[model samples]
Every structure is written in structure tokens, then in C-alpha cells.
Target chain A: MSLSTVAGARLVARKDLRIEQHSRVALAQMLPFGMLVLILFAFALDPSRDVLTRATAGLFWMTVLFTSTLAVQRAFAVEVDDGALDSIRLSGISAASVFLGKVSALVIQLLVLEAVLALGVAILYNTDFGGWAMLVAVTLLSTIGMSAAGATYGVLVSRLRHSSTLLPLLLLPLLAPVLIAATKGSEVALGQEAGQSWSWVALLAVFAISYLVLGVVLYRPLLEET
Target chain B: MTTTFAPKIIGTSSPATRILGVLSIIGLIALVVFGLVISPADFELGETIRILYMHVPTVSVAYLAFIITGVGSVIYLWKRSEFWDLLAASAAEIGVLFFGLTIFNGMMWGKITWGVFWRWEPRLVTTTVLFITYIGYLVVRSIPTDTRTRGTVSAVIGIMAIVNIPITHKAVDWWRGLHQSSTIFATVDPDMRGTQLFSAYLGLTVFLVIFAWLLIHRFRVAWLSERARGIGLDEAIAARRAEGSFS
Candidate 1:
């Protein structure tokens, strides 16, 4: 909550975003890959309009969940080279700042992915969007939880030689709660089901807050580790 | 001098452990007898309740094991001790084993009682996810790396994985609640009388003892392997040096 912490977080987030901007991995690669996954789902499922329409919410977040792994890997992938993380550590920013920073970068990239996937869902599935405000809230809350949880696991496996494979195995199960809340919340937001979307959003908020807090507290121990 | 003929201890064992092993064996037999024969069928659940006798114990012990793993991981992070690292790793291994058994027994019980091997119930899903998370912890431990690095990573996972358990459970619970009544799994009703109660309690005690026995042995194995790895590397280095000098 210190201004310094916020400033440090912004610094790291900007750095990651800058790297991302130059590389265009999120925009060029992940966005296309995410859309392709949506396209693939249409093939896997009954490409018929009704089924795809019902499944849009789940599939969108599921795509987000899958690609968040890539984003996280890239987020920490930047740090794995030439002891960049070590330099960052020696730079005197709090570990929480570094963690928040990474999560922030992840959230931005996933939001972009989600935005495109949302359009893909609308177009390919012939779906209509309703509850715009609720949908945006769900997207923000769910993306925060997903990114925080992803970043936490991301750094834990960052240095392993087999990290690319190991990261998803370790991460996906932990993301179960976030996926459930997000998918369900999106379902309600899309009017595929009745009742309160906010309730599910509140559930997502719980997940978001829990992982954010977890990331902050646990990041220091892992950040200091080799 | 004549060499004395002494039997080699080929495994992690000693006099105390032997006695502990024997006690668990006896307790297991008692449980089997009570659970299979002496215990009467519940009016509601009937003979199927016997599976509960096994199912409850394994899952409970698994929970206990992971709790130890969590605690061990925390202390290791704090104290940087090898004992806690080995203990955490050992407990997680046993926890995975017992959780596997729990699932197997649970599936069998479900097949018999509900005519289905699996259901998308909250408890079932939560248990599966918990199992996988610890499996991840074990995989992290197994990754080839420096001892401190491996321990540090595993410890972080051990801490984080346990924190996710309750959250996973709650999420699944509400996830289920959204659609239907959350009957997920049944608990042993307190109205049980006589041998049924005795068998249930016996099953729990016996399983706890078995878990302790497995944990102690597993810890010894992990500790030995680490020591052996260190010594093996040194000997290899020494041998290569001698070969170089001779050449």
C-alpha cells in the first residue's frame, strides 16, 4: 500500500508491457492462437449454433485459462535469462511489487485475448452478448484471479529446465476455482442461465482476492530463492 | 576372527519400527473382522457402509499427511533444515498414496451404493484436484536440481497447494450448489450402534498408525537417497581424478 510499492509495481509492469509491446507475442501470437482455439472448438463440438452459443462463456474463459499459461511463462520467461530476476531482486523493490507487476502485465494481455475471443465467440458461434457491465466485471475479476494464480505458479517453476511442460501441470489444477467462478459468472452474464451474475462475480472476487493475497505473501520466499 | 552371522537390514527398519509394523498388522486384522463380519448392516446404508469404514480412514489420513506436509514445508522455509524438507516430501508421497486409495475405495463404494463409479459432485472433484496438486509437488521435488533449489521450490508449492485446498472445496461446493442440492457425500451418522461404531473407530485408528509407519519409512528413504547422491558425486569425482593422475 506504500506509494513506493505502487511505483515499483508500475515500473515492473511497464517494463514487462514494453517487452511485450516490442515482441508482440500477446498481440501477434497468443491472440491468434486463442482465436484458433475458438475455431477448433467449433470443429470439436457440434458447430451447430445452439450448442456453440451455450458453450461460448465456458470456452472463452477456458481459452483464457490455457493462454494465461503462455502469458505467465513469457512474463517470467523474461526474468529467467542472464539472472534478470537476480538483478531485479538486487534492485531493492519489494517482492510483492514484482509479483503485482507480473500479475498486472498478465491481466492486460489476457484482457486483450479475452476481448478478441469474445468477438470470435460472437461471430463464429452466432451468439449475442447481453449484460455488458456484468460481463466486463466478470472479465476483470476473473482475469485478476487467473493472472495472480498463474504468476505465483509461474515463478515457482520458472527456473526448472523442464519448466515449459511442468508449469501447466502444476498450474491448471490450482486454477480450478478461478475457472469455475469465471465460467459460471460468464454464463450468468451471457444470459445462458438465469439468476444473479453478481453472485458468481462475487465468487470470482473471492478467488481474485485470495490469490492476490497469496501471491503477495508467498512471492518473497520464492523470489529470494534461486 | 570368525565373523558373526548377522542378518542385514535391507530396508529402513529397526526394532521399534518392527513392533509398530506388527501393531498395525494386528489392528488391520481386527478392523477387517469387525468391518466384514461383526459389524451389522445399517438400516439405511446396509452392507455398503463397510466401504465407508475404509474410505473415511484413507481420506482422513491423507488429509493428516498433507497437513504435515504443509507444516513441514513452512518450518523448512523458516529454518532451512533438511529434516523438514525430507519430511515434507515424504509426507506428500504418502499423502498421494493414501489419497489414491481413498479414490479407489470411494469409486468402489459409489459403484456398489449408487450404481455409478463417479459423479461430478463437489467432494469428488475437490479430492481429485487436491490429489493432482500434491502430485505436482512431488514432480517438482523430483526435478533434477541443486538440493537447496529443489527444496525451496517444493516448499513453495507445498505451502501454496495446501492453501488452495479449502478454496477449491468451497468453489466446487458453490459450483455444485448453483445447479442442484449439495448432497456430495454422506458422513457416518452418529446413530450407529454397537459393532458398526466400533469398526469405524478402529478403522480410523488403524489407518492413522499405518500412515505413521509409511511416513517414517518414506522419510528414511528420502534422507538416505539424498545422502547417497552427495557421496556418489564425490566418489565419481575422486575416481576421475585418480584416473587422470594415472594417465
Candidate 2:
């Protein structure tokens, strides 16, 4: 008997995580690249003034957005390089399982990267911790939303030669809503603004769920084409 | 694949499209005359509001073109027809053209009205995002792939991109309103009367006809090109076969 979709998803996710843990390329390379983006933003803007502190939430989210692209690229690269994708497809796992597995793996990797970048933002930008729980919640929700969209598009473009360049062009515009909602939510969570952050969180949740369902429904056709 | 004859490009244009082409030209002349000379200047915006005739209609048609693209994409995905895919691709090219025009005109209007070339206004930001998204859609089409794969991938992107439009609009509105509450621009309401309304209507009708005309011609061109490419591929394979190459 074939594995259940949920079980297959877990199996795929575990396998991806194991590979990532062994490679460590994402941790060693992408984390510092994200940090470099944050540091460069300070210089490009005004480091001496309080602008970086004021824009910490927006800047931090931008860093995460850029870094998540790397994680997504690496996720598909591994599967494509060794022809593992074809093996996985022929293994009787549902397309939805494969999609969810890739998304989950990307999200975990991004969360780790975000943690490191968050610490960097705290130290460099001097962002005070306010409404810490809300901050974490916003981060988690937006990260899921971003990773879901990213992973879906990543697979969609993986076969193309110019996928690395094309992925961001396709993804960034689609994720504009997520970026806006997350930035606003983080602003409120950081006490920079006075308002309910839950609405933004709700929007992020809706985006995340919508893309996840879309990926599930569409992945079968997408996989067949490959 | 068996080689097929290229379809006649002009055969795609029906009598209705020819009428539309003439009507669109007439309407264009009327719009220019009415907008530049006939419509009275707004009390607040003075002459700058004239840009609205061109700006508003281009954006309206741009939205229409994109909606058509989304519809074509859905139909293509369902029916797996090359005609629908070509239609979608044609409409997207026209949509991108209109989108570019809208942004350019908006920037000009912004400079005259707000004393700046650009701002993070919700509509402007949303249009910019839409522009980038569709441009990416076009770029995806340019990738070297089989026709079916290209059609499938672009159809997926086209549909997904349209779905994001409303979300982007809402998010930008919320983001801008929250951060820039104090910088709101108060101007004449878009509700117009007399010559202003007439010119706006004229512009919209003209642009809509232009879009239809361009779409038909573009679809024909795309079909012919695909046919030519297929013939070329068949010839290449025949030449290789004659050379005693066997797989």
C-alpha cells in the first residue's frame, strides 16, 4: 500500500530537512547574505539617525523576503540535480504531499534564517522588544505565507534555465500583499504604531491558506508536465 | 509533428473588427478635440485634469485586457487549445502597453498636481505591482520550452497573478492610509459633467476598440509564427533523417 498523503508529506519533509542539515549551505551562506542586506540597508539609508530603528520592521521583512528566495532556490535545486523529483513522483506520493513537504521544509529553513536576522536587526538597529508574542506570531504567519507562495512558484519555474532570475520577478509582485500586511503587522507589534495587528495577521493567514490550497490543487497537473 | 500550412493573418479580421478600427480612430480624434479644447478646465486642477481623459481610459482598458487574459487562461487550461493561449498572450501584450501608458500619464499628472513625480499612493503602487507581475508573465512566455509546457505554465501564472490583484490593492490601501494619513490629496471628484464626462466616455470607447483591434491582429500573428516554427522544426528533423541519423 502507498503512504497516506499526510504521512508522505512528513516523510518528504524529513528527507528534505535531513539533506539541508547535512549540506548546511543555507545556514552558512544565506544567513550571512540576509545579514549583509540588513547592514547594507543601514548604510544606504542613514545609519547615524534613528531611521533604521524606525524602519526596522519593514527592513527586517525585506531581508527575510530576499533570503527566502535563496532557500526556495536551494530546495528545488537539490531535487532537480539528482533527479530526485522524478523518483519522488514515481514513489506513489500525491502531488499535494510533495508540495506541502517542500513548503514545510522551506518554512523551517526560513524561520531559522529569520531568527538569526532578527537578532541582527535587534543588535544593529536597536529595535526594542514590544509585544513579543505578537511579533513572533506575525513572523510565523507571514513566513508561512511567503514560503508557500515561494515554493509553489519555485517548482513552477524550476525547469526553466533562467529560473533564478525569473522566480523573483514572478514571486515578488505576487507577494506584495504579504509584504505590506507583514510590514504593517510588525510595525504594530513593535509598538511603532497604535492599532490592532490581528487584522494583518488574519490577512496573512488568508493568503497563506489560499496559496496552500492553490498549490495542492495545481501541483498534480504541474508534476505531470515534468 | 506533421507540418501545417500557416493561416492567413488578415483572415482573422472580421467585418466587425474593421468597423471597430474605423470607429476607434474617429473616437480617438473626438477625444483629443474634446479633451484639449472642448472640456472646460477644472477649477482646482486647471489644465492638468485633462490628463485624466488619457490616463483613466488606459487604466480601464488595461484592467479589461488583464481580465480577458485571465479568462483566456482559464479557457485554455480547460480546453487545451492553442487559440485560447494565443489570445491570452496577445491580450497580455496589449495590457502591458496600456499599463505602461497609465503609469507614464499618472506620473505626469502627479508631477503637476502633487509637485512630485511619484508617491506611494495606493493606486500607483498597485498598478506598479500589476505591471511587474504581467511583465514577468510575458518573460515566462519567452523561455525556451515546448508549446504545451509554455501554455500550461503561463496559464497558471496568468490566473494566479489576477487573483493577487484585489489583495494587492487592499494591502496597499491599508498600508498607505496607515502610514500617510496626513498627506491625502483632495482634488476634484472623478464624477464629471458636461464636456468632461463626454470626453472621458469617448476616450474609454476609443481605447476599448483599439484593444480589440490589437488583440485580433496579435492573435493572428502569434498563430502564423507558431505555424512557421513548426514547419521549420519539421524541416530540420527531415534533414537529419536524410543524413541517416537514427535514435
Candidate 3:
């Protein structure tokens, strides 16, 4: 809440954006990769056209989960690779602020990726968007929760030698609840006949806010750790 | 002859310690014999409820270990004590062991009860995930070269992973799970019998006692190893300083 904290967060966000802008490779790599996954799912499942209607929400969320993993890891990869971590810590800024800034940037990157994937699902599988507005709400909620928890764990575990292998192991299990709620929420928003799936949407919202608060508070100790 | 501060054994080995040991032994005996014999045959499950003797207790104990780990983590972080960190890590490692048994026993049970070895049942799925996360914690522990770093990082992870459990517990309510409902503990009904209820408590108490004993031993070992490693480092540094002074 301090001015310095806000400034620190802004500075960290700007720094990440600048890094992404320069290489732009991280952004470029995921789209084709994500599309390929979608292609594989389509070929593999071979669901009936009627089946696609019911399956769209699951398929859409699956795409987001995998693609977001790819996109999210890169958020910290660059900073860690260049030893910017130590410098950031030494800059007299709060670590929690840095975590907020990193999570914010991740949300932006994930939103972009999810947007593309959502469109892909819509075109490929005829995903209904009747209550599309709620879909967006669920998407945002799930994205924030996933990124906040993922980024916190990713940052803490990044220093491990086998982190690339371990990150998902640590992340996906925890992310399952978020995935379930979000998928169900999106289903309801898609106007599929389901009984009171709005409960899931509420859960997603609660989950996101909880993670946001928790990640901010817990980030300091983990940041100081590395 | 380990010079490490093991859990203190008061004037007469401590009443809590004696009681815990006796209870653990008796419970293990009951689990092996009484759980197999005295518990009535399930109308549906038959002899396989015998498997529940092991399978059910393993899952119950694993959960108990994790809860203790969570508590230990909170204490470790707050007090900044090596004792609490060691306790947490020991509990986590043992929890990992028990959780693995839980999954293993559950899979075998599932193969019989559910006609398949694995399904996306919320109970099994969540527990499996928790087990895997426990292994991930070990990986986290393996990464940090220093004791303090390892302990502290693992503590943070232990705490975070605990946050995942409530969701895991509620997975049955949230998803289309293949697992049966919690008969005894569900909001809709409580179906445990007098013996069944007694057995559950007996199992929990036994596991807690075993966990305490293991924690004390594991913490002692960890403390000693850390001390030994510290000595080695100090000697190496001293040798380097001597070389510098001679030069």
C-alpha cells in the first residue's frame, strides 16, 4: 500500500514488459504450440459434432491450462536467467511488490493466450457463448488464481535444478480445484443445461481473491529465500 | 551417542511418551488382528473389508501426518527455530511415506471394490495428487545445497501445499467423482457404527503416536547431520584461511 510498493510493482511490471518486448520469442512460441495441442485433441477424441457442444468447456479449459503453463514459466525464466533476481532484491523494494508485479504481467500474458484459445475453441468446436459475459468473468477469476499460485510456486522453486520437471508437478495438483470450478462455470455461461453451476463461478471468484491476497503476503519470505 | 537435542525424555521417559508408545503398540495389534477378525464381514465387500484394515488406516494416517506438518510449518516459520523446521520436514517425509502407502493400498482396494485399479474418483484423485505433491516437496528438499535453505524452502512449500487440501477434501462435492460419498462424515448423514467409529479414532491415535516418535528420531538425525556438515565446512574454511596467512 505504500507509495514505494506501488512504484516497485510498477517498475517490476515495466521491466517484465520491456523484456518481453525485446525478445518477443516467448509470445511467438506458444500460439503454434497451443494450436498443435488443439489439433491433436480434435483428432484424438473424434467426438461427434453433438458431443462437441458438451465438450467445449472442458476442451477450452484444457487448452488454457497447458498454454498458460508454457506462458507462465517464461515470466520468471528471463529474470532468473540474467541474475536480475539478486538485483531486484537489492533494490530496496519490497519483495511482495515484485511478486504482485510479476503476477500482473502473467495475468496479461495468460489473458492473451486464453483469448486466442477461446476463439480457437469457438471456431473449431462451436462453443456456445450465449452467456459469454460470465465466461469472461470465470476466465479472469481462474486465470488470476492459477497465475498467482503458479507464479509464487514457480518463483520459489525456480532455483531447483529440476524445476522444469517439478513445476507442473507442484502446480497442477493444486490447480485442479480452480480448473474444476472454472470449467463448470464456463459450461454454465455457455448456456448448457446444468443445475446451478453459478455456485462454481462464485467459488472461482473466491479462489482468485484468496490467492491474490495470499500470494502478495507470502511472496516476501520466498523472495528473500532465493 | 548423538549429541543432538532429541525430543526431551523427562525424569522417567515422560508419561506422554510412554502412553503414546503403549497406545501405538496396542493399536497396531488391534489393526492386524481385530480389524481382520472382530469387524463383521461386509455384505458386499466380503474379505476385502479386510483390506480396509490397512487401506483405510493408511489414508487416515496420511491425512493426520499432513495436518501435523501444517501445524509444524506454522510454528517453524513463526519461531524461526530449527527444531520446528526439522519437525515439519520429518513429518512431511513420513507423511510422504504414509501417503504413498495410502495410494498403494487404495489402488489395490480399488482394483477389487471398483472393478478397476484407478478412476477419477475425487477421494482417490485428490489423495493421489496430494501424494505426488509430497514427492515434489522432497524434490524441493533435494534442491537446496544448504540445510537452512532446504529446511526453510520445504517449510514454505509444506505450508502452501496444506492450503491445497481443503479443496482436495471438497473435490467430491465440486466434481463428478467416481468415489463414494463420505458415509460417516458427510453433511447429509453419519453412518459409522460404535466399533467403526472406535476403530477410526484408534487408528488416528496410533498414527499420531507413531508420527511423534518418528518425528523425534528424524529430527535428531537431521540435526546431527547438519551439525556434522557444518563442522566439515568450518574446517575447510579454516584450512583456506591458514593457506592465506602462510602465503
Candidate 4:
């Protein structure tokens, strides 16, 4: 809430984004992986049965979920390299600022991935983006939820040697509600069902807000341990 | 500070816990006999309903275990104590065990009733998520780290994961409605009567007592292992000093 906190968060976020721009790991490697996951899902599920069209929302969200892990891992891996995280901790910025900064960086990368995957789903699955606004709303809210949860778990496991493997196991179950809501909301947005998409959006918003708050409060303890 | 090599008894069960353990064994035997032999078959389910005795109790105990773990986690985080950390770890282990059993029994029950071993029913889905979350908690605890750090990390995970239970249940239910005919498997209904009610209560009580017994023993084991690790570290440091002297 403090001006300094906001300034600190912006500072951290810019640093992360600048590092990512230089390395381009997410853009070069993770983006293609997300696209490939979409293509693979098409192959795994029969197109002749119209299953791809019907399952497009679920598949697209699955791709995003899988790729977000990579983004999160990269986000924290950057900090671990050269003891950058220790320097950040010692720099006197609040832990909440650092958490917000990491969540923001991860969310930006995930939003890009989501955009690419949306195009892939549209082209390959031929999904009719009927409720386009609802779709975008759902995507943004769910991405925030995922990124917040992902960033928290990423930090929780950052100090462990086997964090890469442990991160998904720790995160995915916690995100099950997000997946369910986003997938269902996507279905409604695609006009596949007459059910309420807004309810799902509400759930996503609640999930996102809770994690954002939790990240701020818990980040201090997590930082202390590291 | 003077360092001693003696193996200190950091944790041990009291007479109360020993008595509870014995009582739980007796109660378990009685419940099994009642559920399997003494209780009459359900008018609807026949012999398959007997699985309820085990299934219901396992899930009940699993929930209890997780609640205890959550409480232990909160206390650990607030107080920063090793005892609470060990308690949380032990409860999570038992919780995971019972959660697995809950799924296994649910699968068997589903196979008989629904002609499939698995269904995305709300309770089943939520339990599956709970199982995986706690398994992750256990995995986090397994990573080699200082006790304080490990406890802090796992405590944070424990608190966060438990908060998801209700949300998961609601979301899964909204995504797909509960199975209509699973009334028996649903929480106890008011229409239930007589021996069936008795058996269910007996099973729940027996399992709870068993959980308590297991928790006490598991906590003691964790404490002993922690002490042993500290002693090992001390000895290694002493050996390094002696080697330096020889050089």
C-alpha cells in the first residue's frame, strides 16, 4: 500500500522483465511448447468425432496451465542464479513488494502464452469465439489466479534442490478450482452450454484475490526461510 | 556449551496413549466383526454395503487428520516449535494414508454399484485432490533441509492446501452435480435407523482412536530421528576438529 512498496514492486517487475527479454527462454522455448501441447491434444483426441471443437476450451487452458509452470520456474530460477534473490532480500524492500513483482512478471509472460494458444485453438480446433468478452475476462482472471498461486508455490520450493519437480505437484492441485472454473467458463463463452459463465468468473476472481492476499502475507515467512 | 553424545529421549508415549492404543485395537476388532457379521444386509445394497463400514470411517478419520495437521501447522508457524512441526508431519502422513484408503474403498464401491471403478463424483474428485496435495506436502518434508526451514515451508503449504478443501468441493459440485443415488454414501441422513447407525458410529469412533494412537507413535519416531540427526552432525564436526589437530 505504501508508495515505496509500489515503487519496489515496479522496480522488481521491470528487472525481471528486462532479464527475460534478454534471455528470451520463455518466448523461444516455452511458447513453442505451449503450441505443441495444443497440437498434441488435437492428435490425442479424435477430430472426426468433433471432440476437438467440444474440448477446445479445456485443451487450451491445459496448455496454459502446463506452460505457466515453466514461466514460474524461470521466474524463480533467475533469482537463484548469481544469488540475485539474496541481494533482493537484503535490499530492504518489503517481501510483499517482491511477491507482487514476481507475480506480475509471471502473469505478463502467461498472458502472452495465452494469447498465442488462443490463436492456435481458434485455428486448429475451429472454436467459435461467441462470448469473446467473457472469454477474455475468464482468461485474465484465471491467469491471475494461476500466476499468483504459481508464484507462491515457486517461492515455497525455491530453496529446495528438487524444486522443479516439486513445484507442479505443489501447485496443480491448489489450482484445480481455477482449472474447473476456467474450463467451464470457456465452455460457456464458446456457446457450447447455456450455463452461467459469470459464476465461474466470480469464482476465478475470488481465487485470484485470495492468492494475491496470501502471497503478500506469506511471502515474508517464505523469504525468511530462504 | 558442552556437547554430550548421549541419546536423549525427546519423545515418548505416556500411559494414557498406551491405554488408548489398546482400547482402539479392541474397538476395531469389535467394529469389524459387527460390520462384517453381526449387521444385517442393506435392503438395497446387500453385501456391497459392508464396504461402507471401512470407507466411511477412513474418510472421516482422513478429514480429522487433515484438520489436526492444519491446527498443527498454524501453531507451528505462530510459535516456531519443533513439536508442532513433527505433529503436523505425522498427521499429514496418517491423513495421506487414510485418504488413499478412502479412494481405494470408493473405487471398489463404485465398481460394484456404478459398473466402473472411478467416477468424477464431487466427493471422489475432492478427495483425490486432497490426497495429491498432502502427498506433495509429504514430498516437501522429505527434502533434506534444516528443521526450521522445512517446518516453515511445510507449515505454509499445510495451511494453504487445507483452505482448498471447501472451495474444491464447491467447484466440483458446480462443475458436475453429485451422484443422486449415492444417498447411503452421503453424510448420515436422518432416515437411517437402528443397527446401521450404531455400526457407522462405532466405525468412526474406532478409526479416530486408531488415528490418535498412530499420531503419538509417529511423532515420537520423528523426534528420535531428528535427535539422531543432530547427534550425527555434532560427531562429524568433532571429527573434523580432531583431524585438524592431527594435521
Model 4 residue A102 CA deviation in Å: 0.9
Residues B140-238, candidate 1, lDDT per residue (tens digit)? 988889998888889888888888888788788878873343232445557777899889889899998998888899999998888779878997998
Candidate 3 lDDT, tens digit per residue, B1-247?
4356455442323566677677778878976666665666655556665566566656766777788778887787677788887777777888888888777777787787778888766667777778888888877776746665666677777877887787656644567633465321122113446554455556656666777766666667777767777877997998899899999
Which runs in model 4 stand beyond 4 Å of their true positions? A1-3, B1-12, B183-185
**What would the per-residue lDDT of candidate 3 be over residues A1-226, giving only the tens digit for each residue?**
3447778888888888788889785568887787778777888788666676678888778877887777667887886898888888888879778888888878887888788887888788877577867877888889988888887877877776777777887888778888888877887777775757667777777777777776787777777766
- Stretches > 4 Å off in candidate 1: A1-3, B1-11, B178-184, B241-247
What i-RMS does every model get? 1.3, 1.0, 1.7, 0.9
How well does model 3 score by local distance difference test? Answer: 0.74
Docking class of 2: medium
With a 3 Å backbone cut-off (N, CA, C), the pairs that clash in candidate 3 are: none
TM-score of 4: 0.95
**CA lDDT, every model vs. true structure:** 0.86, 0.86, 0.74, 0.87
Q: Top DockQ: which candidate number?
A: 4
Q: Tell how far residue A114 is off in model 4, in angstroms.
A: 0.8
- Report the C-alpha lDDT of model 2 over A154-225, residue by residue, as the tens digit: 888998778889999999899989988998999998889977789888888888888888788777767777
Clash pairs for candidate 4: none
Error of 2 at B213 (Å): 1.0
- TM-score for each candidate, following the candidate numbering: 0.93, 0.93, 0.87, 0.95
True contacts kept of 2: 0.67
Ranking by lDDT: 4, 1, 2, 3
